[model samples]
Target chain A: MRSKTRRAALAVLSAGTLLLAAACGGDDSSEADESTITWWHNSNNEPGKGYYEQVAKDFEADHPGVDVQVSAMAHEDMVDKLAAAFQSGDLPDVYMERGGGELADHVEAGLVRDLSDDAADEVEKIGGSVAGWQVDDKTYALPFSLGVVGFWYNKEQFEQAGITELPITMDDLYDVIDKLKAADLTPLSVGAGDKWPAAHYWYAAALRSCPEEVLTDAVGSLDFSDDCFERAGDVVEELIETEPFNAGFLSTPAQEGATSASGLLATGKVAMEMQGHWEPGVMQGLTDDGKGLGDKTGWFPFPEVDGGEGDPAAQLGGGDAWAVPEGSPDVAVDLVRYLLSDEVQTGFAENDMGLPTNPAATGAVSDPALAQLLEVRDAAPFVQLYFDTAFGESVGGAMNDEIALMFAGKASPDDVVSATQQAADEEK
Target chain B: MTRGGWRQRLEILLFVTPALALLGVFVVWPIASAVRMSFYRWKGFGPMEDFVGLRNYDRVLGDDVFRDAVAHNVVIVVASIVVQLPLGLAIAMLLNRKIRLRGLLRTIVFVPYVMAEVIAGVIWFQLLQPRYGVVDGIISAVGLTPPEQGFLGTPELALPTLFVVLTWKYLGLAVLLFLAGLQGVPDELYEAAQLDGAGWWQTQVRVALPLLGPTIRTWLFLSMIGSLQQFDMVWVLTGGGPANATTTMATYLINQGTQRHNYGIAGAASVVLFLVSFVMALAYQLLILRRDTVTQE
Candidate 1:
C-alpha cells in the first residue's frame, strides 16, 4: 500500500513537469515567427542605460517590422551567460566584443562572425580597424568609442593645497601626497573596494612604465614575471606605502563612479582620482553630494614616471565594439549596419557619454570635456587594449588577485610577478 | 473472479509505471549523462569534442587547484564539527532556562540565518571596512593596526575568517535543532541524575547526551554536507580571492565548468566531489547512526 501511494504521487509530479515543458515549446514557435533580435550588453550606468533605451526606441521606429530584445547584463555575467546560451543553441544575436586575446579565443572557438570580408568598407569607415580590434586581417568587432583611463582631479583642490603642477613621476606623486596629508585631505580617493580598481593600479602603472614588447611576450606565453610585472608591482608598493589611497579603501568595495573616488573628488574631499573619462557624467547630478567642488571639473594625462616607457599622453582604455554572433540570420548583418549608421552613432554621442565609433560623428561631438579626451587619444603612442581584454580570463583573474594584495601593501612586486607566472603555469 | 484479480494487478502496474519512468528521466538519466560527459573532452559551448575515457578524471586528480579546493573543504567541515557543534549546544542549553524574554532572544538569535547570504556578506564587508568602519577604526585608534595583512586578502586568514562568518550564519539553526533534541530527552533521566547528586555539567554529559545521540549524528551529517557545498558568501565577499586562497571545491568546479566553460574537466571534478561526499555521508550513517540503532535494539 505504501509503494502504491508513492507511485500515484510520482505520476502526478511527472505529469505537471511535462505540461510545463510542452507550454514552453509552444511559446518558442510563436516567438520564432516574429522578427526578434536579442542583444547582450553590460552598460548599466545611468547615461549608458538611458542611451541604449533611446536607441532601442529609435531603432524600432526606423526598422518598422523588426523587434529588438536587449538582454543586458554585467561584464562578468555576460561571459558565463553567453557560454551557457551558446551551448544550448540559444545565443543572443548580438553582444559586445573584446579584442586582442579575447578576440583570438573567440575566433579560435569559431564563435565570431568574422566581419572582415563584409565589414571591410565599414572597417575603414571607423578608423582602419583600431589596432586593438583587429586579429591579423579579420575584424570581429566595430570600435564605437575610444577611451583612456586618467586621473580626474579638481583644479580648486590642487590650488588650495598649494600644488602648482600635476605630479610627473613617482617622487612628484609622493610630494603631492605629503602636501595633501599636511592639508588634512585624502591624497587619492581610490576605493580598493572592488578588486578591479585595485588591479588598475597594477596594470595601468605597468602600462605607464613596462615596455610594449614585454606585454606582447607575456600575452603569447601567459607568463607574468616579465619585467613589466615587476615594475607594476613596485609602483603599487610605492602607492601603498604613502597612505595615498583613501581610508578604508581595502574594505570598502567600489560601486559606481559617483559613489567611489570620483564622488569624493567631486565633493572636494580629495584632489584627484585614478579613473577613465567615465567619471564626469557619473558625478554631474550627485544626490550624495560632498562639499566645496563647484562647476570646475577636469582631467589630465597620467604622469610620466622615470623608468616608464609609456607616453604621458597615451590613453589607458579601449572602446566598446558591436559584433554579431556566428549563425545569426542575414537580418543581423543589416541590423549591425543600421546600429552603426552615421545618424545613430552621432545620436548616441549627443544623447549619451557616446564617443563615436563612426568617423562621420567626429565633428558632431561638441562636448568640450569629450573633445579634450579625444585629443589625448589622438596624441597617445598606443592606447593599450585594457589588459584584461588583451589577456584571457584566467590571466586576468590571477593578475587582479595579486594586484589587490599589492595595493594593500601585503605583497611585493617580486611576489606579484612570481604569483602571476605560477598562475600562468597552472592555466597551461 | 480470477479475471477480476488480473485486472486489479494490471491497474496497479499502470499506476507504478509513471513513477518508474520519472525516476529514469529525472534521476537516473541525468546521473548517467553526467557520468558519460565526464569521459569526454568538451568545453561548455565550443564545437570541438573528443571522447577520451578516464582522461578527464586523470586531469582532475592531477591538478593542484583541485587538491587545494578539497583541502579547503575539509577545513570547513572540521571547523563546523569542532566549533559550531559545541557552541550551538551550549547556546541551546542556556536558552532552555526560564529567563525574561527567552522567546524574543531565540528569535533574535536566529535572525542571521534568515538573512540572505548576499545581504549578510555585503553588510559584513562594510562593517569590516578598514578606515571608516567602526570596528577597524576603533582597532586602529588604540595604536594597533588592524593586523599587518588585509584580513580578507591574506591567504592564511581568508578561509578561516569565512568559516567564522559561516558559523555565525548557521549556528542559529544548529541551536534550534539541538533545542528540539534536548526537549526529546525525558525529564526522568535528569531527575534521576539530580537525585544522584550530579552537577550540571555531569548531568549533561552522563544523562542528557546519551539520549541526544541521534540529534548529534543528524546535525553532524547536515553541517558537514552544507559546509562542503558552501558557495554564496565566499562568492559575494571575497570572490575566492588573493590568488584562489578561499576557493572551495564546489566554487572551483562551478567556476571551471560554468564560468570558464571547461565542461569536461568540471564534470570530472564534480564526479570526484560526488564520490567523496557520498562516502562521507555513508560513513556517518554507518559509524555514527546505524551503530546507535543496532545498540538501541
Candidate 2:
C-alpha cells in the first residue's frame, strides 16, 4: 500500500509537470523559405477579407517564384498572436503595424526595417499620415488606412431624446446626455470592461484640453507633468458622475454581440458610442438583419472643450500600416508599395473598409457619413494616435488601468495623473 | 542479488533514459531556465543582458494587483475545501444507495466536468449578463431585482460569483471520485458497525469517512493545485477585470509575458507560483499523508 501511494504521488507530480511543459513548449515552427511573404491582417470579415485575398493572388501572379501567404484574423487575436510570434522570433515577413511606441520598441530591437529610402514614392503619396509611423523623420511603415474617432450615434434615438442638433462643446454634450436620460434612454454606451474603450474617453478629453505641442512633447520626454492631462481626467470624471452610460457599462464588452456597447447603439438601445470608422461594420455584424443602423447612423467629431487651448479640429485616431521585418527580402517592400497603389486604395475606399491614406482615392469614399469624417480629417491641424498604441504596451497599459479605475469610480483624476507619471518613470 | 547484476542495471538504465531526457528537456530545464530568467530584466525577445537581481520579485510582491490576485487564488482554495468537497461528498453518499435512474443521474451530474473550461466560462458569462441574461430574466419573472452592476461585473461579488461557477463546473469530478472511493469501502464494515449498535449517521461518520481518507487527501491536493493554477475560466469570464477582481497568478503571468512583454517579471511570478505549489505538496505529504504510509507499512 505504501509503494502504491508512492507511485500515485509520483504519477501526479509527473502529470502536473507535463501540463506545464505543454503550456511552455507549444510554439509553432515557421517555414524558412525566403521567397514566401507571410502577411497578417485584422480584416477577417467579408469584402475586406476577400479583397485582401485578391490582392495577394494578384501580387503572386505578377511576380513569378513569389508566394503571398495571407492570414486574416480578428484584431485582438492578431495582437496576441503577433506578440507571441515576436517573442519566439517567428515573426512574419510583412504584417500590419500600428505605429507609435510599439513601432519604436520594434525599431529599437532592430526587428523593423527602415522603409524611407526603399518606399519613398509610397511614403510621399500617404502624406502626413505617415508621421505616426516615423521616428525622427525616418519611416518604418506605410499607413494604408487613416480615420478619426467620433460619435457613431443612432439619429432616431437623438430625435426621440428631443436633441435637434449635434453638440459643438463639452457643456452642450452634457446637455444632450441629460436630455437622453430624461427620455429614459441610455445616453452613452461605453465598454469600460475592455479598458481601451473607456481609455478613449480620457484620450478625447486630453485632445480637447491640451495643445498639440504639449501632447507631442509628452511622448518624446515621457513627462506627463502638464495640467491638461489631469484636466482631461477631470472631464471624464464629471461625465462619469452624470451616470450617462448604460446600466452595466463597466462590465459590458466593446463589440462582442447584441449586448455589447456597439451592439447597444446598433440595436437602438443606446443613443451613441464613441468609436472609430470601423464602427459601422462592427455594428452590422452585431445586428440580426445585417443592415445595422444603416441611414439612421450619423457621425460627429468629438465635442470641443470650451475655453481649452487645443484646436477643435485636432482629432484622435489610428490606422493600420504595413511594415517589413528585418532581413526581409526586397519583395516585401514591393508588396507594401503595391498595397498603397492608387488602384488598391481606390478599391479599399469603395468597399467602405476605411479612409484610405492615398490622396488620389479621397473621392472614392461612397458612404456619406465617412465622407463627412474625411472632411473633418482633412481640416484637422494634427491627429493623435490612440494613446495606448502611441505609448506602447507598458505605459499605455498602466494608463489604461488607472483610467479604468476612474471609470469604476475607484480612482480620482489626481490619482490617474500620479499613477500614469509613476508608470512612465518605472517603464523608463 | 541477481536483480542488482550488471545486465539488469544496464537494462533499467536503458529503459529510463528516454523518460529522463524528456523530463529534463520539458520540465527540469524549463524550471531552471525560468529561475535564471527571474534575475534579469529581459523582454521575451532580444538579449538577456540586464540583470536586475530579484528586482522583478520585489516589484511583483509590492504590486497591489498581484497581491489581490494571490488573495483571489487563496479564496478559491478555501472555497473548494470548505464548500465544494463537502457538497460533492454528500451527493456521492446519496447516490451510492439503491435508486432509480442512478446511472442517468450520475451521468447528468458528471457532464459539466467534461466540458471545456473556456466554453463553460463563455456560457456562464452570457447566462449571468446583467439585464438580458436568463438569470436576470428568471429573477425578474419571480419578482426580484438583480444587482445593478450584475454579478461578474461588480468587484465585491465577482470573485464569489466565479466561485459558484467553479463549484458548478468542478463539483462533478469530486462526486465521481468519492463515488469510486465509496465502492471500495467493504459492506462488512457497515455490518460490523451496525452490530455494535451504530446508527446510520454513526456508520457514515465512524466507518465510511475514515476508510475514504486516501481519496479525500488526493482530492484535496488536486483541488488546491488546480485553484492555484486556474487560468482559462477566469480569463474568458472576466479577463481579470471590472478591476483586476478575478486575476489569478497564472493570468497575471500571461498578462505580463504575452501582453506587456515583461518576461522577467512573468518568470519571477512563475517561480513564485511553482515554489508555493511545491511547498504545499511537500507539507501535505510530510504532515498529513505520512501517517497513511506509516500505518499501511
Candidate 3:
C-alpha cells in the first residue's frame, strides 16, 4: 500500500510540473485574432470616459465584424499595467505613450509600430507636435494633446498680495515674491516629494538659460557640460534662496489630495504653483464643490532669466500619444489615425480633456484658462519636452533626486549637474 | 533487498518529494535567477545580454545613496531592539499582574500588531503631517513649537520619527511574546519566592527574568530581522525623502529596479541584501539560538 501511495504521488508531482510549464510557456499573442483590436486608455472619468466609449462604437460601426475591446483604467493603473505588458511582450493593440526617451526606448526594442508611412496624411495634419514621438525621423506614435507647463496662480491671492502686472523677468518675479511675502502669503508651493515637480523648476530654468540649439543637442548627446546648464541650476538656486515656497514643501506630494501642491493653489492657500495644462482638471478633482479656483484661476508663462541665451518665448512641455504595438493588426493604425482626426480631437477639446494637438480643434477649447494656454503653446518658438522625460527614467530619476536634494538645502547647483551627468554617462 | 524495507523507503520518499519539488520551484529558482540577473546590465524588459560581471555590484556599493540606505537599515535594527526591549518588557510584566481589567489592558497592548502595516502607516502619515496634523496641532496647543517642515519632512528627524512609529506598530508583538513566556513560569516557583519574602520587583528580576532568557533572545532575533527588512512604513511615511534621509536597503533596491529601471543594479543590491541577511541569520542561529535548541535536545 505504501508503495502504491508513493507511485501515485510521483504521478501527481510530474503532472503538476507539466502544468506549471504549460502555464509559463503559453504565448499571449500566438492565438490573437485579426478581427479583434484591444485599446487601453486612461480617460476613466466622466465626459472623457463616455466620449471615448462613443468614439470606439463609431469606429466599430464603420468597420463591421471588427471587434475593438476598450479598457479604460485610472492613469496610474494603466501605466503600471502597460509596464508589465511591455516586460511580458504581450501588449494591447494600441495604448498611450508619453513620448521622449521612453518612446525612443520602445522603438529601439521593436515594440512600437512606425506610423510614418501608414498614417502619413494624419501625420502631416498633426505637424510639429508629433516630433516628440518620432525616433530618427520615423514617427512611432501620434500625439493627441500637446501642452506646456507654466505657473498656475490664484488671481484673488495675486490681487491680495498687491501684484499689479504679471512678472516678465527674473527680477520682476523676485519683486512679486517679496510683495507676496510682505502680504504674509506663501508665494509658491512645489511638490518636491514627487521629485518631478521640483525638477520642473530646473527644466524651465534650462529652457530659459540655454540656446535652442544647445538644448536640442544636449538631448541627443546626454551631455550637460554647457555653461547654460550650470546657469539654469544657478537660477534655481537664487529662487530657492528667496525662501518663497510653502512651509513643509519639501515633502509635499504633487496632485494626490487637498494637502498637495496643486491642492494648496486650488484651495487658495498659496498664490502660485508651477504645473502642466492639466492643473485645472486636477484642481477640480481635489476640491469638494468640483469648481477648483473657480473665477480665481489664472495662468502665466515662466519668466525669462537675465542674460539668458534661449528665446524668451520658449516653453517646457510634453504630451501623451496613441501608439500601436508592433504586432497589432492594420486596423489598429486606422483607429489611431481616426482618434487623431479633427472631428474626434474637436470633441476631445469640447470635453476639456486636454490641450488638443489638431489645429482644427484648437478653437474649440471652452475653458478660458486652457484657451490662453493653447495660445501660448502655439506662439512659443518651440516647446522643449520636460528634460526628465527626454532623458528617460534612469537618468531623469537621478536628476530629479538631486534637484529634490537641492530643494532641501542639501545639494548645491554644481552637485545637480554632476549627478545628472554621471547617470547619463552610465546610459552610454 | 527485503520487500518490506523497499516499501518503507518508498513511503518516506512519497512524503518528501512534494515538499522538495515546491522548494526547488519557488525558493531556489527565484534566488538563482536573481543571482544570474546581477551579472547583466539589461533593462527590466529586454534580453539579458549585456553581461557586466561584478560591475553592477561595484556600482551598488559605490553609490552614496545605497551606502546611506545600508546605514539606515543598521540603525533601525539596533534601535528596534534597544527601544522596544525594555518598553515591551515593562508593559508585559505589568499586565501579568492580578490587576483590574487585565484582559482589557492586554487586548489594548496587542491591538496595533493585529492592524495591517499599510493602514497603520497611512494613519501615522496623516497624524504627523506638518502644520495641520494632529501631533503638530497638539504641540501648538500645548504652546510648544513643532518642526518647521513637519516631523517626516525634516532631514534630521525623518528617521527618528519613523523609529517612533515603528515602535508603536511592533511593540505589541514583543509584549505578546513576553507575556506568553511569563505565563509558562510555574506557580510553585512564585509561591516559593513569596514565602521567602521576595518583593514583586525582586521576584520578577531574580526569578522570572532568568527563566525568560530564551524568549527574550528569540524576540530580539525576530525584531532585528523585521527592522532590517523594513519598507512599507518608510515608503508611505516619507518615501525616503527630505534628502533620502530614511532609506533602507529594501527601498533602495525597489527605487533602482522599478522607478529608475536599473534592473542590474537592483539585482546586485538584492544579492548583497540576501548575503547580509543570510550571514546575520546564520550567525544568530549558531551563536544565539543554538543554546535554546541544545538545551531542548
Candidate 4:
C-alpha cells in the first residue's frame, strides 16, 4: 500500500512537471526570417469580401517577408471577438474597422496604435477627408467606404401615383406616402425586423435638431436625453401615422423585411424605401434584371423637418476603415503607405465599395450612383458617424433601447428625451 | 502500531487532495476574482481600476432598466410555475403511458431540449419574421394577418413573445424530469389500489402523485433556478428591446458589465442575483429535504 502511494505521487509529479514546462515555454516571437501578421476582417459579402481578400494577398506578395493572414467575421460577430481579444490583450496586428470613433473604446483601453503622423502625411494624397477616422488631433482608423441613408423611391410607382417629383420636405413626403397608399401601394418600405434599421428613425430625427457640436458631444458622452431625442419619436409617429410601411411590417423579422422591402420596391408595390447606396446591391440580390424596381429609381436626401438645423446637405452616414493594433509588428507608417498607395486606392474605387479616402482614386470608379454619392460626400458640411460607435457601449445602450421604444410606438418623441436623460443621469 | 489505520488515513488524504485542488482551481478561484473585481471600476480591458465599493451596486439599483430587468425575472419565475410546470407534468404523464410509438414520441418531444439556444432562437426568429416568413405567409393565406405589427417589434409583445419562446425551449427539460419521477413510482402500489377499487385518477392522486412528491419538488427547484438565469434568447431576440421590456437579470448584468465596460456595476448586479438565487435554492432544498426525511421516517 505504501509502495502504491509513492508510485501515485510520482506519477502526479511527472504530469505537473510536463504541464509546467509547456505553460512556461517561450513564444519564440523573435524567430528570424518571415513574419506572420494576423489581420482580422468582418467583410462577409461577395465582391466586397473578394476585393479585400485579393488586396491582402497582393500586399503579402509585394512584401516577401511579411505574411498577412486574414480572418473574416460577421459585423456584430467581430465586435464580440474584438472585445474578447481586447480583454485577453492579444489583439491581431491589423483588423477591419467600422468607421467613426468606434475604435474609441479600444483607444481608451490603450489597445489601438495611433496613426496620427501617418494620417497627416496621407491626408495630402487623400484630400480633405477627415470625416471617418480622426479622433482629436490623431487618426486611428482610415476611411474605407461611405454610406448615406435616404429615400430610394420607385420612380414608376411615383409616376403612376401622379407625383412628378420626390418629396423634399416632411409635409411633402408624408403627403406622397398618403398618395401612394391611396393608389393601393405600400407607401414606403422600412425593415423594422432588424431593430437597428427600425431604430434608425430616432437617430434620423435627433440629427435634425441636435446641433452638430451637441450631437457630437452627446454621442461622446452617451448622454441620452429627452430634449434632443424628442424629435425622433415625433417623426417616427408622424411617419407611422401615414401608413408608409407595408401591410405587415411589424410582424416581419429583419431578414424577411429585407426580402419584402426589396420585393415590394422592385415590383412597384411600394413607392419608396428608406435606404442607402447599397439599395442597388440589395436590388440585385432580389431581381435577375438588376434594373431594380424601376429604371428611374433614384435617391433623395432625407427631407428637412420644421425648424431643424440640418440642411439637405447635412447627412448622417459613416463607413468602414482600417487600423493596426498596437501589438502589430509591422511599422504603422509602411502599412498606411502601402494601404493608401494610388494603386491600392484605385483598386478600392474600382470595386465600387464606396467613395475612396484617397483623392487620387477619382476616375477609377465608374458607377454613376456611387459617383453621385461621392459628389454628396464632397458637398456635405457635416458627416455624422453612427451613434453606436460614438459612445461607449453602456451609454450607447440607452440610445439603442430608447430608439427601439420610439419605433415600436411605446415611447413618443418626448419619451426619447426622458429616456436619454435618464441614461445620461445613470451614466454620470 | 496498527499499519492499517495509518494507511487508511493516507488513502483518504490522497483521494481528497485531487478534488480539493480541482475545486480550488475551477470554482473558488473564479468566484474569488469576481468578488474582488466587483469592488473596482474598470472596463474589462483597461489596466486601471478605480476602487469604488458599493457604488456599483448603487448605480445598478438606480438604473431603471436594471429595476425593470429584476421585475422581468420575477415575471418569468411566475410564468414557469403557473404554466411551464403544469404543461411539463402533463407531457411527462403522457410519456409514462404504454402508448404506441412512445419511443418516437419521446425522442421528438425531447429533441428541442438539446438544441442550442442560438439555433433555436434563429429558427423561431425565421418562423416569426414578418415580411417573408413562412408562418406569416400562411397566416396571410388564411385571411388572418399574423400582425402588420412585428410581434417582437412592439413593446407590448416583446416580453410575452420571449416568455413563449422560453416556455417552448424549456418544456422539454421539465417533461424529462417529470417522466423520471413517474417511472420510479411503484406499479404494485397502483395495482394494489386498483384491487381495492380505486379509479385511475384516484390511484394517481392517492398513490402515484403522492409518491412523486420528491421528484416534483426537485424538478420545480431546478426549473425555477434555470428560468432565473435566462439570458441568451432575450439577447438574441429583442436585445432587451422595445424599451427594455424583455431585459432580464443576466442580460442586464452582461450589458452593464461587459458591453458598457462597467465591470463594477455588472459585478454588483451579479452579486445581487447570485445572493437572491442562492438563498431561494437553499430554502427550497431545506423545505423539500425536510419533507423527504419526514416521509422516510
Candidate 5:
C-alpha cells in the first residue's frame, strides 16, 4: 500500500514537472520571428487601444512580410513588465518610454537605440518637446504627447463660493480656499495616498522658488543645497496648514473609481484637483452620465509664489515618447516615425488622449480648456519634467516619502530637504 | 542488501527525487542567489560588477522606514496571537456545540477563508471608506462622527484597522482547524468529566483544552509565519502609506526592489526577512515542538 502511494506521488510529480517545462518553453518559439516588430504601449483603453491596433495593421499592410505585434497594458503593469524584460534581455522592439531618469538609465546601459540621425525628421516635427526625450542634445526617442500639470476646477463651484477671479498668487489661492470652505465646499481634493499627487505640490513650489539654472544644475549635481529647496518645502507646509483638501484626502486614491480625487471634482463634491492634462477623460469615466464636469471644468496654472526668484512662465510637465531598443531592426525606427506622422498625431489629439507634441496636431484638440492649456504650455519659458520622473526612482521615492510625511504632519520643511539630500547622497 | 530491500529503497528514492529537485531549483536556488546578490550594488539590470559588501545590509538596517516596517510586522505577529487566535478558538468552541444551524454557522465562518486576499482587502477598503462606505454610514446613522482621515488613512488607526481586516480574513481558517481538533477529542473523556461532577467550563479546561494542544500549536505556527509574510492585503489597502504607517517588512522589500530599483538593498532585506523567519521556525521546533517529540517518544 505504501509503495502504491509512492507510485501515485511520483506520477503526480512528473506531471507537474512536464507542466512547468511546457510553460517555460512556449515563449521561446514565439520570440524567434525576426520580421515581427513588437510594440508595448500603455494605451490599454478603448479608443487608444483600437487606434494603435489599426495603426499596426496599416503598417503591416504597407510593408509586406512584416508583422507588427502590439501589446497594450495598464501603465504601471507596462513599467513592471518592461523592467522584467530588461532584466531578461527580451525587450520589445518598440516600446513606450517616459523620458527622464528612467530613460537615462536605459541609455547608459545601451539598451535603447539612438534615433538622432534615423528619425530626425519626426523629431523635427515634434519641435521643442522632443528635447524631453534627448540626452546631452542627442535624441533617443520621439515625443508623442505632452502637457502641464494644473488645477482642474469646477466653474459652478467657483461661482457658488463667490470667487470671481482666477488665483494668480499664493495668497489669492489661499483666499479662494477660505471662500470655498465658507461656502461649505471642499476647496481641493488631493490624493496623498498615491504619493505622486502630493509630491506635485512640492515640485511646483520648488519650480516657483528656485531659478531655472538651479533646477537644471541640481539634476546633474544632485545638490539640493540651495535654501530655495527648503523654501519649497515651507510653501507646501504652509499649504498643508490651510487644510484645504477634502476630508480623508490623505487616504483617497488619485483616479481609480467614483470616490477618487478626480471623481470628487467631476461629481462637484470638491472644487479643484491638481492633475495632469488627462484629468478630463478620467473624470468623465467616473461620472454616472459620462459627461463629467463638461463645460463647468476650467484649468489654471499653479499659482506663483510671492517674491520668488523663478519665472512664473516656467512650467512643470511630462509626456510619453516612443523608443526603439538596441539590437532592434531598422524597421523599429520606421515604426516610431510612422507613429509620429502628422495623421496619427492629429488622430491622437482628436481622441482627447493628451496634447500632441507634433506642431501640426495642435489645432486638432477639441476641448477649449485643453486648447487654453496648450497656449499656456507654449508660452512657458521653461518646462521642467515632473520631479519624480526626472529624478529617477531612488532619489524621487525618498523625496516623495519625506514630502508625504510632511503632508501627514509628521515631518518639518527642513526635514524634507535633509531627507532628499541624504537620499541623493546615497545614490551618488 | 537483499533484492527486495534494494528494490523498496529505489522506489522510495524515485518518489522523492522529483520533489527534491523541484524544490532545489525553485526555492533553494533563488534564496542562494538572493543571498549572493545582497553583497552587490546592482540595479537589477546590466552586469553585477559593483561589489559593495555589507553596505546594503548597513543601509537597510539604518533606514527609518525599514525600522518602522519591522515594528509593524511585530505588531501584526503579537495581534495574531493575542486577538485572532483566541477569538477563533472561542467561535470554534461555540460551533462545536450541538446547536441548531451549526453547520450553516460553520460554513458562514469559513467563507472569508476561501475569499482571495486581494479581493478581501479591496472589499474591506470599500466598506470602510470615510464618507460613502458602509461603516461610516452606519456610524453617521447612529449619531456619531467617523474619523475624519478615515481608518486606513489615519496613521494611528491604519495599522490597527489592517490588523482587524487581517483577523477577519484569517480567523475562519483558525476556527476550522480548531473545530477539526474538537471533533477528534474522545466523547468518553467528556462523559468521564461529567461523571466526576465537572461542569462545562471545568470539562473544557481539564480535558478538551489539554487534548487540543497539538492542533493549537500547529495553528500557532502557521499564524506566526503568515503574519511575518503578510503582504497582499497591506499592499492593496494602504500601499504602506498615509506616510508608511502600514508598511510591513515584505512591503518594504518590494518597494525597494520593484519601485526604487535598488535590488541589492532589497536582496539584503530579503536575507534579513528570511533569517528572521528561519530562526523563528528553528527555535519553535527546538523549544516547543521538541517537547512534543520527547513526550511522544
Candidate 6:
C-alpha cells in the first residue's frame, strides 16, 4: 500500500517536471528565432492572400536572414485574435490596424511602435491618409488603402426607374427614393441590425451639415454640442420618414449572406446600398455566379445636405493600415514601409483588392466602378473617418444604439445627440 | 495514523488534486478576476489601474438597456415554467403510452435538444426572415398577414417570437425528463389505481403526478436557469435588437464587454447576473428542493 502511494507521488512529480520542461522548451524555441517577423493580415481569400505571400517572399529575398511569417486570417477572426493579443501583450510583430480611436487606445497603452521616424518617406507619400493613424502628430501606422464610403447603386435599376442622373443633394436623393418607390422597388437597404451600417447615414449627414473643423475637433474633444450635430440626426430622421429602406431593414445584417443589406443590393432586391469600397467584393461573394451586380454596378457619393456648412465634396470613409507592435524588430518597420511602397501598392490596386493610398497606384485600379470611386475619393477635400471608429466603441456604440432606436421610431433626433453626449461624457 | 490510513490519505489526495486544480484554474480564478475587474474602469486591455469602486455596478443598474435585459430574463424564466410544465407533462404522458413506433416518436421529439444550438439558431434565422422566409410564406399561405417587418424585426413581436423559438428548442428536454419520471413510477401503483376504478385521467393525476414531483421540480430548476443564461439564440436571431427589445442579461453583458470594449461594465453586469442566479438557485434549493433531499435522506 505504501509502495502504491510512493508510485503515485512519483508519477505526479514526473508529470509536473515534464510539463515544466515542455513550457521552457516552447519559450526557448520562440526566442531562438530573432530574425522572425510575424505578420497577420485579413486577406485570407484569393489573389490578395497570394499577393501578400509573394510580397513576404520578395522581402525575404531582399533582406536575407530576416524571415517574414505571414498569417492570413478572415477579417473578423483577425480582429478577435488581435484583441486577445492586445490583452495578453503578446501580439504579432506586424498586423493590420483599423486606425482612429482603436489605434489611439493601442498607442496609449504603448502597444504600437511609433513609425514616424522609421517609415517617414512612406508616411510622407501616404500624406493626409495617415491622419487616421496619427496620435499627437506622431504617425504609428502606414495606411496602404484609404477608400471613401459612397452609395453603391445598380445602374440597370436606376435606368429602369428613369433616374437619368445621380442624386447630388438631399432633396434629389428623396426624389430618387420617390421615383424608385413609384417603380415598385425598394430604394435602399441599411443593415440597422448591425447598427453601424445604419449609423453611417448619420455620419454622412453630419459630414454634410457640420464644418470640417468642428467635425475634426469633435474627434479630439468628444463634443457634440454644435447644433449641426443635431441637424445631422434631423437629416437621418427626415430620410427615415421617406421609408426608402428594404423591408425589415431594422433586422437586416450588414454583409452576411444573400439576405443582408449588401446582399439585397447585390441580388437587385434593392436599388442601392451605402457601403465602403469593399462593396463590390462583398456583393460578388453573395451572388450565385459570383458576378455580383457585375458591370451594372454604379458609384455615387452621399449627397449634400440643404443649408449645410460643410464641403459637399468631403466624403465619409475609413480604411486599414499596417502597424508594427511595440518591441517589434526595426525590420518590421522596413516591411511596413515596403508594403506602402509605390510598386507594392500599385500591385495591390491592380488586383482590385482596395483603393490604394499611393498616388502612383491610383491609376492602377482595374475595376471601372472602383476607378470611379477612386476619382471621387481623390477629388474630395477630405475623407472623414467613420464616426464609430473615430469615437471608439463605447461612445460609438451608444450613438449607434440611439440611431437604431430612431430607425425603429422609438428615439427622437434630440435623444440621439443626448445619448451620444452622455456616453462621451462617461469617456471624459 | 496507521500506515494503511496514511496510504489511503495519499490515495485520496492523488485522485482529487487534478479535479480541484482544474476547478481552481478555470472556475474559481475567473470568478475572482471578474470580481476584481468589476471594481475598475478597464477597457478590456492595458493595465487594470483605474479602480472605480461600484461605479461600474452603478452604471449597469442605471442603464435602461440593462434593466430591460433583466426584465426579459425574468419574463423568459417565468414563462418557460408556466408554458412548458403542462405542455411538457401532456406530451410526456402521451409518449409514455405503448403507442406504435414509440422509439421513432421519442427520437423525433428529442431531435431538437440533440441538435447544436448554433445550427438550430441559423436554420431558424433563415426560416424567420421577413418577406421571403419559410415562416412568412407559411403564414401568408394560411391567409394571415405576417407583420410587415416579419416576426423578429418588429420590436413588439421580437421578444415573443424569441420566446416561441426558445420553447420549440427546449420543450423536448422537459418532455424527456417528465417521461423519465413517469417511467420511474411503480407499475403496481397504476394497477392498484385501476382496481380502485379510477379513470385514466384520475390515475395520472392522483398516482403519477404526485410521484413525479421531484422530477418536475428538478426540470423547473433546469429550465429557469437555462432561460436566465440564454445568449446564443438571442444573439444569432435578433442580436438583442429591433431596438434592444429582446436583450437578455447574458446578451447585454456580451454587448457591453466585447462589442463596446467596456470590460468593467461587463464585469459588473456579469457579477449581477451571477448574484441573481445564485440567490434564486439557493432559495430554490433551500425552500423547494430541500423537501426532495429530506425525503431521500
Tell me candidate 6's fraction of native contacts, as a decimal between 0 and 1.
Answer: 0.63
User: B1-297, model 6: which lDDT tens digit per residue?
Assistant: 899899788788887776675676668889999999999998877899999999999999999999999999999999998899999999999999999999998888889988998899999999999998999999999999989998888999999999998998999999999999999999999999999999999999999999999999999899989999999999999999999999999999999999999999999999999999999999999999999999999
Residues A313-338 of candidate 2 have per-residue lDDT tens digits of: 89999998999988778898999999
CAPRI-style quality class for the chain A–B interface of candidate 5:
medium
By DockQ, the candidates rank as: 6, 3, 5, 4, 2, 1
Model 1, position A46: C-alpha lDDT score: 61
Ten consecutive residues with minimal summed lDDT in candidate 4 chain A? A25-34
Worst 10 residues of 6 chain B by lDDT: B17-26
RMSD (Cα, Å) for all candidates, in order, is 4.5, 4.8, 1.8, 4.0, 2.5, 1.7
Per-model CA lDDT versus the true structure: 0.72, 0.88, 0.91, 0.71, 0.89, 0.91
Per-prediction DockQ scores?
A: 0.28, 0.30, 0.67, 0.43, 0.53, 0.68
**Two-chain complex of model 2, DockQ on C-alpha atoms against the true structure:** 0.30
Q: For candidate 3, lDDT tens digit of each residue in B1-297?
A: 999899788778777877776787788888898899999986777577899999999999999999999999999998888889999999999999999999999999889999999999988987887887899999999999999999988999999999999998999999999999999999899999999999999999998898899999999899988888889999988888889999999999999988988889999999999999889999999999999999988
lDDT of 6 by residue, A1-428 (tens): 76876788778767656654664453243232559999999998989999999999999999999999999999999989988878867788889988888889889998899999988888888888889999999999988888899899999999999999989899999999999999999999999999999999999999999999999999999999999999998999999999998888889999999999999999999999999989999999999999999999999999999899999999999999999887778888889989988889999999999999999899899899889888988898888999999999999999999999999999988999999999999988
Tell me how many clashing residue pairs each candidate has. Answer: 6, 0, 0, 19, 0, 0
Per-residue C-alpha lDDT of model 1 across residues B1-297, encoded as one tens digit per residue? 698798778677767666676677777776776787888866555664678889778878877667888888899999899998889989888887678999998998799999998899877665555454555777888987874435664567778778878988999989988889999888898899899999889988887777778888888899999888888988776666545677787877777676444567778887888788889889888788897789779
Chain A vs native chain A, TM-score per candidate? 0.85, 0.91, 0.96, 0.84, 0.94, 0.95
Interface RMSD after interface superposition, model 2: 5.8
> Mind giving the per-residue lDDT tens digits that candidate 1 earns over A311-377?
5555568777887777776566666776688877787777655567677776677666777777777
DockQ of 3: 0.67
Candidate 1 residue pairs in backbone clash: A148-A316, A148-A317, A193-A252, A193-A253, A209-A308, A248-B131
Better of 1 and 3 by TM-score: 3
